[model samples]
Target chain A: MNTYDLIIVGAGPGGSVAAKIAAEKGLKTVFFERGRKPGEKNSSGCGLGPRMFRDFPEMMKKLTPEKCHSMRAGVAARNYFVNKDDIVAGYIMARPTESVSYEPAKSWITMNVYRSEFDPWIAEFATDAGAELKTSTLIIDLLKENGKVSGVIDDKGEKYKAPIVIGADGAVSTVAQKSGLRSKWSQNQVTLTLQYDFQAPSEKIDDIMGDETLAVWWGSNFPASYQVFFNDGFHQGLGNWMTWWDKTPLFYLNRVVNLKYYQRLLKILDAKPRELQAHLLPWLDYPYNTYTDGIILIGDAGGFPCPLEAEGIYPAMVTGKIAAEVAAEAVSSGDFSKESLKKFDEGWKKTSIGEEFEAGAELWNIWKALPFSPKETMSWFVPMIMEILGGIFDWSQPHGKRVRQIISHVKSYMPKATPFIMKNVFPLVAKIFEDDLDKIMDPKKIMKVLPKLLDMLPQKKKRRGSQEK
Target chain B: MKIELEGLTKRIPGTGEFISINSLKCNNCDRCLFVCVMNLWRKKEGKIYLAEDYQSKCLECAACFQVCDAGAIMFKYPAGGTGIVIEKG
Candidate 1:
């Protein structure tokens, strides 16, 4: 049996961060990943926030020029069609500031990265800090001794022992399950999202997207939830909710609806789709306890993926760092019990995760209730929310001012005509401030309850297929 | 050749789940090939191909299939005793 002070499963942002922090603190940390390399199995339209640079300054210092790609500004555009053939588009632009510098084309600077390049770059920081990384290895089970998690068992029946185990294995977390930290997630608690990365010629991309701004297209035709993101040059990623697939018999029908919408977009840009890739993203909605005796879950394993934006990289890294802090404290104390690890859970909820989810859940519910047309939602609701937030709160302000502004904005939006926002929104937002305000001050509560309210809203029936095996 | 698209929809090689591809809707953009961490997509001449060459390397993250825009890349859990077999280090 191999032993270590801490063992982290999965080498995505979460696992790697945890390993780096633990190793830097002089703990014997060993990280395991099933992928051939750190970022090999990971993919995302990631927005690496500035706060990450503040938290992990050392890791940032290690970033080589090849590893970082910069974006200048962020634009949210909507394509509205008068008919199946004729479409009009509009956009909203925002400049990045000191606090929110990661938006595309911001003067403060933000970078877009290929996970394949980014994950290993960060993992190297951990290895340099003396953490052992085991790649191409699958962790099959949790070694439970006397009803407590002792370590992990790999497929080869080799048991690696550790005082603590951190599950950062992503949304479909094997470590979380094997360690008995969480039950199988409910569909409602998860959002199945699919995205596409289209490769185009650089000049074509520059002509279509222009220079260095991230462009987002919302409310095209698929649903109120559709978004297409343009990154770097020639790379565009589009995503839509998968729940809609249940309503129609033909899976491709959903794609057709999206494609038709994009066809109009293609005309606008005079560009064609070049390599299209799709993926299902598990967005966490409901809160699940993410810690157990000798075990803790971080990143997607803890359901920390931002439910609204589907952004996980920053939060994953943040949570991983927090988890490592807790693990270090536990290891120094020579104890790895649920009670010892409770600080991680408590600390996480106190941070941005709780508030972000609350806001995301509320936003999801309101969006779900809006008519299925993406055009209407994007044209009216999405911008309305952003404008409202921009008006009430300034992202460049201090944390206190931001919180106050968020509260004021929520109060204002609560009475709006959108029943989903009015009914499900305020209560969820209130929850974020009501109980956890001292520990965490996030405006995300308003976003959490929207889905449940949407479920209550009368909607169309779904067609069943020969049930998926 | 009589081709039942429905038959192709059943069973995702290793896992006991049915994965299907709407071949008619497939645009062959090859996005899944780029996103697949295992390099499961191969290019034959001008067309895109899906192979299991590095299938054993798949962590089942589903990033490739999730990023397929045309619904062309379908996944069926591999049959019993077949698919990416992972080993411990």
Candidate 2:
């Protein structure tokens, strides 16, 4: 019988952040993790943006040379045909400054850390902030009283009571289900992903991936997915997403995109494929109510992953912080009702985190509609944008000039280039580039719907029939 | 090598050292067959059969193990040291 002000389940990024924030706010917080350690069961590409660290400056302060790993930089995109004949729109030899340099082009700044190291660091931050952390404990069920969650019940039948229960559990969340917050997710809402980590010599990695660029291959003869090359110290990690096998048969799909295909791509790049490990990931899209009476679901459990990029770490952290903020306020007021916890959603909406998911969903739908031809997607946009940004205008300039140039380019090109642009460029720009650009330029109105754009597609049906049942 | 079983054992499909083929639950999806790194399983008689060629090549990376939702594929650590032995990449 252990009681606390807040009990956070699943010590992933979301759980740790909630625990840390709650403990820092002087609330009695207990965090439970099923893994042997914080990140043991976690796997991700480590493509986290700098803003994640900017928000949680304490995590960065705790990062040590041994704990942190860095990639100098790498190429961003590669385009190869399904026939394996020609790499028409390849970008393996691009410079770091070409894409994301203005933000901070630290050669060794972008790191590829094993979640084994990274997750524990965040968990330790929670413990250091005075939150009690229990590992090797699986939270099997929720303890409810009068239709309100009061605590958690673990596998060993041990019960711990808390005024607020935060479910930071990953995609397959038991807490969310037991709380009657959301139903089983449909296959369409989940993206089945597979990633591989390989061990290769540093020289080999540098030779193949180039000294300064993470390579992202698209529209290759391979699956409609993205592949990343990370040079983290001694290991060169490669991760890719696979199409949903439940929708398509794996053997037919695998024959099309297997080790042979990967080997051929590596050979083209003059890189050798090594010891590989792959795992599946489930990503959510539809919004499920995340808060209820005395309980809040954060992170993947809340379906908070960015649908387009499939990035979850930053959003998980942001949502975790918001949940903790609401939990703290509720605890202080001696009220753990659903009305008080509604602030979690309100606070999350106020931040860019909520906008990221909403925009990401829209972007995902647009991407799904577009053709998966890498040559068609990149040839028109990449070179055109590169010429405009690199050849025409200098990136190192006042923000206003850059904005004016882009606006003028769009305005000038609209009349003559509308058809071609709409056919090819609109999908990529609208889906990936627009929201991110809007976030940077005007945070106030980050979501910008292209007029008459959505109407172009048939109206999507409501969640009916099998989707809901 | 074919061996006959008695009673309940006859009712159950023989389990291999590395693979546990639950012929009943398998939907012939071939997810296990395709996702296998070692190319172990194949379709025959509308069911997946573990290939002898895969005995030496199984890396034990467990990609097949994780992807198979049908519980048709299972891997136990090969007796001591008989699977994929990696030197480098």
lDDT of each: 0.59, 0.59
Question: Would you list the clashing residue pairs of candidate 2?
Answer: A73-A212, A73-A213, A74-A212, A74-A213, A74-A214, A75-A213, A75-A214, A82-A221
Which lDDT tens digits does candidate 1 get at residues A1-469? Answer: 7999999988888888899889989889999876567765555545565566666676775666555442222342333322222233334544454565342324433455556667878888889889999986778678878887788987657789997899988776777667766544553554444333333444555666553345444443444333333343223433344334323212322343345445655556554433222334556564577887888888888877776655777788888989999999998998887888899878877777766765666655654545344544433555455544454545577645565455444454443434554455554565646654424433355345654454443333354584767
lDDT score, candidate 1, position A87: 36
Candidate 1 segments whose C-alpha is farther than 4 A from its true place: A61-64, A68-86, A97-110, A224-243, A247-261, A264-280, A357-361, A370-421, A424-469, B1-89
Query: Which stretches of model 2 miss by more than 4 angstroms?
Result: A69-89, A92-110, A207-210, A229-286, A370-469, B1-89
TM-score of each: 0.65, 0.65
Relative to the true structure, candidate 2 reaches a TM of 0.65
Docking level of model 1: incorrect
**Best candidate according to DockQ:** 2
